[model samples]
Target: MRNKYAIVIICIVALVIIEKENNIILRVSDKLSQFRTLQMPETSSFVIIDDNSSYPDDIYSENVLGAREKGQKHILLMATTRSGSSFVGEFFNQQGADMFYLFEPLWHVEAMLSLGTNGTNSSTSPWVYRDVLKHLFLCDFSLLERFINPPPKDHVTPDLFRRESSVALCENQVCTPVIKGIFEKYHCRTRRCGPLNLTLASEVCQKKRNRVIKTVRVTQLDTLRSLLEDPQLDVRLIQLVRDPRATLASRIVAFPSKYQDWKSWAVNENVSVKEEEVKRLEGNCNNIRMSAELGLSLPKWLEKRYMLVRYEDIARDPMQKAAEMYNFTGIPFTPQTRDWILENTHSHSSGIFSTQKNSSEHVEKWRFKIPFKLAQFVQEICGPTMKLFGYRFVDNEQSLVNKSFSLLEEKKFHFS
Candidate 1:
């Protein structure tokens, strides 16, 4: 009887111990569930990791996070070479001390990688272009230094392509101290500001409220999806397109040696439409049309991020278009920007890459320059692109040269 009583006592004691262990496990599981819930909120603003080594954690913590915290604005002025990009880019470049603008920084990328690649294909990978642009937008100039020939030493490069075009780089902090009288008029390259202190440029970039970069290197729009979707950046893209015939005419004059065959064809009027140069032009048109179509489609990622602006439209009314662009980018169209546009657009400076011009006359001057046959050839090849952008075709030379007969149709492109 005593042995039976002792066995019952042991059984009861075992049951009590198991109950306490079960309660402890349930309490631990509840605490773990709360921890997981806390982690969920961070998913909304996580860093995008492309490559571990290329984009170190420090860069994300410092630059990307900093930009996000400050709510900085980024603007990308995208266009083809000689498509009035330089002219259109000036609107953003001349937006006073608040804006930091980089003029064709990708020229260094292309130049560095041009070796061993066919001219038809991009010498550098599109990802390289995108990466460089991404860093630049975030005010991180370290990545771009890799492409600078002779490489930047201690973050200084004298050979930054077209350094003078960027007023931000030319001004006080980035360039050397200006002499009181003798060197007062000169700035940047002419000023002989010592090798560009890229570190200082980055510091200036961080101080500005806005960053704008103009590039002809980004041939396709979709390649920018990663950049557009980045949680850290509020990027706005403006794609400036000109009539292909006008672009070709401008290229023939601006890059005569490169377009020697086109020049000869313009003079001789005997080149076949199937020539390699003509085929290249056709490819360029198709790329532009494809990108425009994608942007106009209003995909979920591109909502309110993409804008297509015709060079002709801006040339027609510089101030109005400038205001529209500023409004689109959520920037205040300052009086300084307005004044600069009024002065520059009316000026008659016609250098190959000069942004200042009587834009109204410059838009149609191509008709007089390009031969009738060449213009027709461009129309035949770039017809779909031209039509999509509202450029009307000329039936004959009489219609082409008639200044009163406008080639532009009353068409509007809208994006969400």
Candidate 2:
């Protein structure tokens, strides 16, 4: 009887050991491949290891030595229109696996936030920007960029939402190496609570550096604080601002036709110093007030999750600025990442900002063309904000405020 009892006990122990080993493998394998169908066991309360692929690809196991070295951080780049955000984003895109280009997490966040499903008063224009970043990060979107410039698609639609892998969390096409050191804000409603293995995360898994998130709508301080609450999520803020003089000059010169009707009496939409319209536009600065409100919307609160970035610094030397940002986030900038930065940091090499797009280039050219008085007014109205970013305020030299066709018509000028 003793011998038979002992055999039964030994068999039970062997079964327990086998089950434990299987569970470990299950978890590890989830980080190795994409899983189309995943079902969690009732007993398991954490992320279930899921992989539709019976075999994994080499990309899953690829690691970067610098990543393991651990001295860099993730990047979150944000700014307003006419700012050099795209330039900054392009500069960071060269990080290989260590960095990701999250063009706009706001698109996605604002989309759901607008739904106000839980009482969030968000509008569609900006919220969609936040959520778009969330949607892209959760999935591999290399192919999506093939269609458009800056962004392949103009709008973030519901059809783009999907549940994918985050490598360490589980495997899928979304696996990338640079993120080993830092985490950008990636919102997934399905992600559950659990402890993370920092020891495992220390491994250098990508030859690239950390990731880049270029979602400018994230100016609200309250919004940023709420997003950074996730311990698993690392959100570093890179605030970008442009000089109002330069930005306004660029806007007018680049889009001269939009604001002005060259075909008729020229009028400065911003109100000319000499024309009756200057008072009209100056009196009703609602549009300017609204646009300026975006800057004012930034919460006065400060958090460690973010660092302010300047547009001039980026345009002057994107690589150097990128390295500084990488260091700020604590992500190692490997030689490989450095090389990627060297190769891909060329501004306007591609897209709407490309040489092919003369309209956008007008921004750079307007420095000489803008009439003195009009430029002065632009500086006067947007001076404080512009000076904050390094643009100089001009004196009211010659009141040759350039007028648009509409303003000219307002003057009731008779035809020759």
Please name the candidate that would achieve the greatest lDDT relative to the true structure. Answer: 1
Determine which window of 10 residues in candidate 2 has minimal summed lDDT: 407-416
| Clash pairs, model 1 backbone | 304-416
lDDT of 2 by residue, 245-351 (tens): 45555555456664453212224554333454344334323333333343344443333554555555554565676777666666666676566455554434534
| RMSD for each of the candidates | 20.5, 20.6
Error of 1 at 128 (Å): 0.8
TM-score, every prediction: 0.82, 0.47
Task: State in Å the error of residue 87, model 1.
Answer: 0.9
lDDT of candidates 1 onward, in order: 0.79, 0.42
Instruction: Estimate candidate 2's alpha-carbon lDDT, on a 0 to 1 scale.
Output: 0.42
Worst 10 residues of 1 by lDDT: 38-47
lDDT of 1 by residue, 1-416 (tens): 99999999999999999998676545434433432342211212322223221333444456567664676889999899889998888898889889999999998767655532323344225766776787788777876776676667788676788888898998768876533443222247434676678889988998898999999988889888888777678898998999999999989898988888877766675653346776789889999999999999989989989999999999999999999899889888989899999999998887888889999988999988888888998899999999999999998999899999999998899976
lDDT of 2 at 49: 24
